[model samples]
Target: MYVPKNFQEPDRDTLFQFVRDNSFALLVTTGDDGIPVATHLPIELLPGPDGKFQLVGHLAKANPQWKLLGRDTPALAVFSGAHSYISSSWYDHVNVPTWNYLSVHVTGRTNLLTADETLAFLRQQVDKYEVHSKHPVSVESMTEDYVRKEMRGIVAFTMEIDSMQGAAKLSQNRDDKNYQNIIAELRQKDDTDANEIATEMAARRVDNGQ
Candidate 1:
């Protein structure tokens, strides 16, 4: 989250879009003994009337991590997007190797939702992910009794994110010659991460009038 000025992404909408595209994130918190715990889960972002973002997600009932969701415990959600290694060989000038990546960190207080709210939360998640399905399923498709029984096994919570920071280090600090060279080399790789970072770098060039 310590983003240098040139790498800091200040656009709120762009940051939120990154979260939506990469919905799965690392939810971290500290326990009573001060041991840090992290849980990986998919999340939904809800914009509040007060212009705050609420991160919504559910954890299995058996997961003790959910106990950290209280006003006393601070929650940090981290969403990581494309990342790739930058080989010094790709740069036109002599330079050390580095990595480029995009990520966002959100810190806020969290609270568990009521049972009714949890059910609604699950339905909303289904709607969001079922778009690609030819036969989309709905919570209404299942009996209320069965849904209630299944809901007992999970804990839903929402974090009203008070702070959010985004970093997009896609060779923006490099000169165009070296930047374009890195992107060209990266695009030659078959790896997804490499290709994605390359695409972002190319877009940055267009934004810079290169």
Candidate 2:
């Protein structure tokens, strides 16, 4: 989250889109014993009545992390996008190796959703992903008794986003000569993540009118 001026992504829309693309995020909260607990889950962002973004996700009922959720409790959702290792050799000039990546950190207070609200969220979440399937299965297609029994095994909560910080460290600090070289080398690699970081760097260049 410690983003430098050159790497910081200030656009709210961009950050929200990044979250949507990388919906499976890390949720972090501290316990009473001061130990941090994290859960990896698919969290969706929705607009609230006050025009603010809220993150919604569910955890297994046995997961103790949900116990940390409260109106006053602080929570962090971390969305990690494409990332790749940048070799110093790829740079035209002499430099140390580094990482090029995109990430967004959201901080807010979390509250547990009501049972009815949780069910609605579940149905919506199911539809969101199932739409891509050839044979999509929906919550409404299931028996009411079965759905209710399944819902009882999870806890759903929402975090009203108070702040979001995005970092797009795609070698923006490098000069054009080195930047172009980085992308070229990344594309030559067989790694998908490397190719994605290269694509992002090229897109950023276009955005900056370079």
The candidate scoring highest on lDDT is 2
Models 1 onward score TM values of 0.95, 0.97
lDDT of 2 by residue, 1-210 (tens): 689999999999999999999999999999999899999999999876578789999999999888899748779999999899999988766789999999999999998888888888988899999999999998889965688899888999999888999999998888898899999999999999999999989988988899
Error of 1 at 38 (Å): 0.5
Alpha-carbon lDDT, every model: 0.89, 0.91
Error of 1 at 36 (Å): 0.4
Q: Model 1 over residues 16-79: C-alpha lDDT tens digits?
A: 8999999999999998898998999998898654776789999998999988887666799999
Q: Count the backbone clashes (under 3 Å) in each candidate.
A: 0, 0
Please state every model's RMSD to the true fold in angstroms: 1.4, 1.1
- Model 1 weakest lDDT span, ten residues long: 45-54
- TM-score, predicted candidate 2 vs. hidden true structure: 0.97
* lDDT for predicted candidate 1 compared with the true structure: 0.89
